[model samples]
Target: MSGLRLEPVTFAQACAFVDEQHRHHRAPRGHKFSIGAAQGERLVGVAIVGRPVARHYDTGRALEVTRVATDGTRNACSTLLSAAWRAGRALGYERMITYTRSDEDGASLRAAGWEPVAVRPPRRGWSCPSRPRAGGEVEQVGRTLWQAPGSAQAPS
Candidate 1:
């Protein structure tokens, strides 16, 4: 096992890391909590967890990992994800979820024991006729939704 360790991370710090390192998505606007993975004094990765993005799942009992960024450190992503779930569970959360682009392999999520439960199709963008908002630089790609501790609420 790696000497990767988990520590509390401020939302700002976590967001900064994600902004600098994430392949596509920008940092999230807000988060409920954040965790960092470190090998000694250096931060190797970060995870930001917040209320579920999907209205249907935003029941105050579920949390979503909005961002995760790693400096290519081994096991850093896996460690941070595991800690994120543990922290959520400790806070009495009933479910934890996160989404990965369709192109991602999700090896770290799988290593952290999260299972893919759904595949969400891509939309044109966040902006539509109802609300006129700026389109993001990142393309709207299909995403895989993953949940921790398996398929308790998963559909057949």
Candidate 2:
């Protein structure tokens, strides 16, 4: 992980990486911005941050780390996560959040100073009677929301 460094990434690039490497979720439709973890010239991971998916947390000052995908690189995930909150705080966002499935441990989140805020119940899917939708690969699993604590250094 010594050679790993954060680099500015385009939305398309981040989405592509997630599509190719993520374990479950697909690339998000959009983002406020994207950050990448690179080891020398190869991009090892990406983090996409944008408005919260839950309408309730979509306050103007809130941002969510919608997708984080890594190519099994050591420390890549935690590094990107820490950078995300730094970027969020530098932009004046009051809150930053992300989630991990109930079965997944949040070691990276803990390493980045994020704390668990909720244990969300499992959902059948995103499809509902009111608005039609297709739940992607992994939707039925319950998840835990993790929120970044206080402020941090500016964008990393």
Candidate 3:
């Protein structure tokens, strides 16, 4: 990951990068803003931040890291997480949160100074007769919620 640089990137560019490089190979439905990591001229990773998907977390001061995709570059995920928190704080957000699947190690989030707060149970896929959904692997898995250091705890 030589010459690694972090900079703001548009949603479209970040989505494309993530779709191409992420192991999950899925782009988020939307994002408020994104940060990109570049090794020299090549974009290697991106973190997409936006309002929390859960309505309970829709407080004005909260933001969530919706997706983090990296090209296996060392420290790229940590760099993006740290930068995303800084960017949130700069924009007057009081907290930043993210989730990792239960089976996935959160080493990158921990390295970025985020703390695990809770383990969310697996959710049944959102498939109603009216609004069918294409379930993915993530939906069947539990997740661990993590919050950036110094952020307030989420409301119960």
Candidate 4:
């Protein structure tokens, strides 16, 4: 193995990463994963996963992915997705899922094992968590969006 490592992000780190994403002009609604790809002291990529409601489809849990970026030269999609997968699994989720616009190119997700179950635009009027980040600057993610892994579906 070429020495690849993944780490779980703390709430503080998650807030910082989400702030960075917001600075970069991306939506920071769902960002629970917050993984970093580093070789020693250098960070090569970032991947974040969050649990949201599966309202888009009639079934399955919504595991949203955000800020999946790599150093162009290195293929980081697999590493990132794998980290998110492990996190989701650790959280007790049985299956993983994501969403993308109908016209958007989701090659990275496809390459990383995220299958597109729907092509519809995300629903309007998302609700955020009642409690915000401790700091007035950072906002906490929505609570209603996510469900415990085993709780979403009963054994079939």
Candidate 5:
């Protein structure tokens, strides 16, 4: 981990790497930016930031961490989370948020200075005929939303 670096990456590259290494093996759509963590020349992890998928959070100043994928590299997740926040701030976003399934630990997010803000209730699958979605393993699970530290105030 000595030569680890965080750098901007294209959505295609991030999606490819995430599909290979992420547990769910699913790539998110509509990311605004993707950042990668590299160990020397090899990519170890990625974080995808984008507009919030939830309609309630679609404000112009709020962004979301859509995905974080890693190849089991220590500290990669936390590093990518931190870098995502820095990138968002640089781009003038007021708040950054993300969600983790209830059963999943939030150590990486906490290490990146994010705080658990709320626990969202489980939802039924979103597979209506008009808006069919590929069923996901965590689709119906409860999730805990986390926000970057100091973003408690409403986004401007």
Candidate 6:
């Protein structure tokens, strides 16, 4: 498997890679994923999959793919996400869900067998940053409340 390179990304690494992906794709935070694509030592693309957001549909045990993007000429989102799906399945996730702007080139996602399940209406509200103190350090951490739709308070 040396020829195939896909791996889990740290939160900081995911932030950086997602920033690069969003720079081109304009993906929103709710669609955040945690995988990176690389060719040898060079980074190429990223794919993110997590639970559905409160503003979106519920994907129970269904991973919601937030964004996928490539750098330069290397198109690696498919490979990365395929690996992620396999990993997700291994971890007991049953399905994957995703949303893309109608104008975005999401053919790779379609080709990878993700079909549109719901369309998000245009957003209109201002969102605030959520930062809390941890061990006396200010940290930007996701609130584990029932944030996602159809979610209950579960221990993290």
The most accurate candidate by TM-score is 1
Q: Residue 125, candidate 3: how far off, in angstroms?
A: 2.3
lDDT of 2 by residue, 51-154 (tens): 99987788788899999999999999999999999899898998898889999999999988899988999987766788678744447789998899883222
> What TM-score goes with each of the models?
0.90, 0.89, 0.89, 0.56, 0.88, 0.63
**Whole-structure CA lDDT of model 2:** 0.89
Output the TM-score of candidate 3: 0.89
**Model 1: lDDT to the true structure:** 0.87
Q: List, residue by residue over 1-156, the lDDT tens digit for candidate 4.
A: 145566555545555544554333253566555787666665555676765434443244446554455554255556776677777777766665554444446666666655544344343334447533443342322221222223344224
lDDT of 1 at 82: 87
Model 2, poorest ten-residue lDDT window?
147-156
Error of 6 at 133 (Å): 23
Candidate 1 TM-score versus the reference: 0.90
lDDT of 4: 0.52
Clashes of 5: 0
The true-versus-predicted C-alpha distance at residue 98 of model 1, in Å, is 0.4
Candidate that beats the other on lDDT, 1 or 4, i.e. the better one: 1
Candidate-wise lDDT, in order: 0.87, 0.89, 0.88, 0.52, 0.87, 0.56
Writing each residue's lDDT as its tens digit, candidate 6 over 1-156 gives: 334477667656666766765654444455434787778887677776767654334546666566666674344766765666776676776655555554555556555554444454554333434533334322232221112222223223
lDDT of 5: 0.87
Q: Candidate 3: lDDT over CA atoms?
A: 0.88
Q: Which lDDT value does model 4 have at 34?
A: 79
How would you encode candidate 5's per-residue C-alpha lDDT over 24-115 as one tens digit per residue? 63889769999999988889999999998876787888899999999888999999998898888889988899999988999999998999
**Where's the lowest-lDDT run of ten residues in candidate 4?**
140-149
